[model samples]
Target: MHIEEKQIAINKVAALLKNSGKFVLSIDKNKDGFIDTGTRKITVFPDTPAEMKSYIENSGLLLIEQFETEFAHIFIAEKG
Candidate 1:
């Protein structure tokens, strides 16, 4: 997704949560390729880990924890 769209989505998510509600997001940092799910092909948007983190924090959510796996970055944020 484009940056503007991503931010808008984040804002929407943030608006839905109650105060102190937690949001968990997992982003594939290496999503530069397409995925074939047998029946359809899914296009993954290329978004960096840092950019995603920034988006989460900038949406009035306080980042509480973050970690990375071999394939993705996971962020735990709370609506503040």
Candidate 2:
């Protein structure tokens, strides 16, 4: 998704959360787009971890914890 669309989605998620509710997301760590094996199509604009974090934080969600795996970054955020 485009950056603006992604941010809008994040904001919507934040708006849907009840007080103290948690949001968990796992995103590809690589900024470089990769091909989808099933569809044989390449991702054109995947959000970077930094961008995703910024979006979540900007949406009025407080970041609780974040971790990185071999291929992805996991974010745990809470609606204040």
Candidate 3:
């Protein structure tokens, strides 16, 4: 993603956090669009995907999504 999109995604993720916690933020590029089909990294929030979902769902930020894993959970907030 571009710098602007990256910044927007970061802000969205930050707004989704309820408490003060560390989050992994990166750009995910294994997507369809050009922005999503490169060496993109993702911003993984310290909170689980569940927590991110709640905040994101209600934060009015409609340009991102959340994903998670089992052992090493991964949360991805993208700009759509």
- Taking all chains together, each candidate's TM-score versus the true structure is 0.87, 0.80, 0.28
* Top lDDT prediction, candidate number: 2
Query: Model 2 over residues 1-52: C-alpha lDDT tens digits?
Result: 3233888889999999999999999887666666566957665468778888
lDDT of 1: 0.84
Model 3 residue runs over 4 Å out of place are 1-4, 26-80
The per-model lDDT (C-alpha) reads 0.84, 0.85, 0.44
Q: Worst ten-residue run, lDDT, model 2? A: 28-37
lDDT of 1 by residue, 1-80 (tens): 32337888998999999999999988876665676789987776678878888899889899999999988889999997
By TM-score, the best candidate is: 1
Which one wins by lDDT: 2 or 3?
Answer: 2
Clashes of each: 0, 0, 10
Off by over 4 Å in 1: 1-4
The residue pairs found clashing in candidate 3 are 24-44, 25-43, 26-41, 26-42, 26-43, 27-40, 27-41, 27-42, 28-41, 29-36
Task: In candidate 2, list every pair of residues with a backbone clash.
Answer: none
Distance (Å) between predicted and true CA of 79, model 2?
0.4
